[model samples]
Target: MINKGANDLGGFLRSRRERLTPDAAGIEPGVTRRRVPGLRREELAELAGVSVGYYTRLEQGVSTSASDAVIDALAAALRLDPAEHEHLRILATPRRPTRPRARRSKLRPSVRDLLAAIPGSPAIVIDHRADVLAWNRLGHALLAGHVDFDAPDSRVRPNIARMLFLDPHHRALYRDWHAKAQVTVAALHQAVARHPADPGLEHLVGRLAVDSPEFARMWARRPVRTCSSYLRELAHPVVGRVTLVNETVTLPDDDQQIGLFYARPGTTDADALILLAQSFERRLAPGTPSRKEEAR
Candidate 1:
């Protein structure tokens, strides 16, 4: 039986193993009923061409230094996709002294300007901790209209992951909250593995774990997910239902990711975005009463 020890890698391995059946791994089930779930330690070790003792040590967090060939073999045996394979590699890699991570990461002015260039679509730049670093007007309107448009310019930036779990408005925005929650939590895990020394990311994870039971439940799953592009269904307060393709690209120079969300041209979804833009424009027009003013 595979058990997760104190190690994150061990936890991840345990989660993966639980989901993979012996029949799926092409192992014939014996007539004897199994007591523990998933492929046994010895079975997986045999498939990876490693001794059961060494594999057990690796899973138990006693030994983390696994060869590339062994990682590759294990990945193949487990049928991991590209992103999952990369995540596994990061977990197994030895930790090194990393430079201090700033709480608010700066983006080149050119990139910020680029975000504004696409007026029709919504775009945002976020750091590894999922803190909003910069956002286009439409992006702010779509994701966080309740927030000040210039919130990202401040020292204390709003974190998307935090809002997703804790803020009721943000939680209501997603049509499928569970799906988005899972992906967000998994991304956090990936970030921690890649940037082991990032204090900001560390704090975010700790904060969410304590404050949000939903986040805590998802975090315990030891998920690892990296998505370049996905569809997001939003129940926008102004525009009603919206389906947009969220495309994210990692900036080469830094760990920041820039994402643009847009719908296919000429669809009702596009029309919904157009309506959202119009409402936002009117709200920001000259002499328009602000949310605070209206509240007063």
Candidate 2:
């Protein structure tokens, strides 16, 4: 019997394969024209030191006997990054019980302290589901001042992926909305693949697909993006135009991470961040309700 998981593995492989170009793979272009965008199945099979028949069967979702060595060769031939390689392994692994594993969403005390330590910088702790577990005052103010900081941890917790596509305020925050949206969707795609048996995540994806047309379109594209340090331009309602380098610190032995948003020290954007932090601090003083408390 053909395994459905193996079928998905095949599709994932094909997608990654198509992302590579023949020239990029060090293949010289011949006079004979090719049809597809990337390297042919035979070309890839040869590069991975596998039979063409085996590679073709793998791509067609009809083969499930690929060994670890074969998968590693395929990854190397496709030039997959660390995250992509991990993803490929997941797809190729045999699926057992679909029961969801216990999700660890609680932020460590040290991680929470780390967020408070970075006053001037906007930082947040998020789970694999992109749910904002905790955020510094500046982080709340910078990203979603209109919403409560405590709201994320509340019953109706706010997820970054959900807000990117569904919330008007969140959508307006990005200067390049479409580029940011694409990245957000692609990252979520990776997340979904990472936690395939998580029913909650599957529900989130289904809800987004039903509610947001743009999300459905992007999700259909099956774009895979691994989140890393990247620059983002935000049109904050309070701070106006601000650019920051968002760095993610993947927690050790945990599924949560702290995302720090900071501008270059000597720049005007850095100055803006400082000002925003100060404003949040002032709002937290006696007699003044925090933006979060007031929202409650």
Q: By TM-score, who's the top model here?
A: 1
Q: What clash pairs does model 1 have?
A: none
Q: What is the TM-score of each candidate against the true structure?
A: 0.90, 0.81
Q: Worst lDDT window (10 residues) for model 1? A: 1-10
Off by over 4 Å in 1: 1-7, 288-296
- How big is the positional error of residue 41 in model 1, measured in Å on the Cα after superposition? 1.2
Per residue, candidate 2 scores C-alpha lDDT tens digits across 230-273 of 78988998779998998988875777778899887989999999
Deviation from native of the Cα of residue 32 in model 2, angstroms: 8.1
Query: In angstroms, what RMSD does candidate 2 have relative to the true structure?
Result: 4.2
